[model samples]
Target: MTNAVTFKILEDIARDLSSDEITFPTFLDITFQVRSALKDPNLSVEQLAKLVGAEPLMSAKIIRMSNSVALNPSGREIADVKSAIVRVGMEAVRTVSFAVAMEQLLKSKQMQPFENLSQRLWEHTSHVAALCRVLARKLAKINGDEAMFSGLVHDLGVFYLMSRAANFPELVNDKAELHALLVGWHDNIGHALLSALGSPESVLEAVRDHETDREISTVSNLSDVLYVANKIANRSSCWRDPELDGAVDTSVLDTLFDAETLAEIIDESEEEVQSLKAALGG
Candidate 1:
């Protein structure tokens, strides 16, 4: 499938999914699945414990991961499922599990066209997540772990597109270059899909309004985080958009960390990506 057709199918899927009045049961199912596979973004660590503990499998995984040598910085043993979730935090738990758990759900024949696409998407999202953290701490002088998580999942719309390709072969066959073809368009699509899936308003808004002009309506801070995080994606390759270079809507851009700080963060993120590439023998 070419890139053009993929986006076309995505548009159709978006329209069809949007037009269908999702029933309460369906809504609840989506909510349950998203929640079950991951923790609530708004829930506190203690709250995450109770929520995750409700599901035995997730709790076990959480506990095992907390006891994993890599995540447990201090190497303290977790006593319970809740404690494990609290120690790791909801997004971290969600990040670890969602990618692992959703695999079977997203499997299909058309997924072949996207062979390695999903893997690259994960790598890109993870890098963007890391960049978001770097930007938040070094540039904005703020904690952006949450921002990093948001960045990590922002391009999930593309994943949904791949999943739907089984149903829409034209979309599966889209042939254009990926970045040039669908950049501005996918935000609304992502927003609607995740909203239909019962994500929080902040996440939806970040997806839907991330690219919307402020004159149309001011974007939320979370959207700002996504916008800049995406803008700096692929180690500043996306930032060369002449269309957006001098454009207004300084709301997020102004609040973005200073240019010098951003430069440092970008350099560091490049190093991180390179290190990851080297680790993978790239």
Candidate 2:
């Protein structure tokens, strides 16, 4: 509709976020609980198993991930929860837990009306996450897993907006209309939601700043990696929207890594990217 009307809708979305009126999928609660609990330095494998075991689906996913080709290149498969946790490491478990939680979130009954849109977003997110990991590892020498995690949740705002928009079908019934709202506000709204959810500082900054065309900080960080990875991922996939291409700042490639090097890196990581995407069920 009108710009004023759109602004009002965005304001309502912000209010819902602050008021905790917007609901996340049920599995996220368990994911958060386990995530927080895992942060305890004194937590033992037995205690970790006990905590994760409470949720059968989470436990199963953890085991499955532990056996994935990325982490467990060895042929030995992990059968027990304790072994799975040890095999995957706490950091990986935390990341995969959220991935599984997101899968549940996407499958929620509320998402049925926007299933096609949700799936597209999820696929884009998965690609971004894979590319982020590769970029972090090869270019920035950062923690690839953590970068991947950041990439996975970078678009939290888009999902939040869609779920809330489900409350007002008139605003989102048309695909073009909903996309316009997402393009306008997803970054700001994502920043707010991630802050509320206690996301890491690196991830929060990356997600909030990735879309902007700006100079690099004194030193390279995850944000730079995210911006580059997001562009590369979009280019490699069909998700790149022509209308939004000009919004990206290509200069980051020169400051960070040359386009040729970046493309080669992405090309080399094709197998790894596909494997990681399948692991995340992208």
Candidate topping TM-score? 2
lDDT score, candidate 1: 0.54
TM-score of candidate 2 versus the correct structure, residues matched by position = 0.84
Please provide, for model 2 over 1-282, each residue's C-alpha lDDT reduced to its tens digit, 9 standing for 90 to 100.
544556777887666677856554464676678777876899888898888888777787778767766667776888888898887777766777777777777799877887877787778888888778877877689998888888888887787777767766666566666677887788988888777767888889999987887766422579988887776666545343455433444566566566796668778878777777877763
User: How well is each residue in 134-192 modelled by candidate 1, as lDDT tens digits?
Assistant: 55655455545566556655766665544555565554454334434445445665666
Model 2 alpha-carbon drift over 4 Å, by segment: 1-9, 19-27, 215-219, 238-260
Candidate 1 has its poorest 10 consecutive residues by lDDT at 273-282
Question: What TM-scores do the predictions have?
Answer: 0.61, 0.84
Off by over 4 Å in 1: 1-12, 19-31, 34-82, 95-97, 101-109, 137-145, 177-184, 211-220, 236-260, 266-282
Clashes of 1: 10
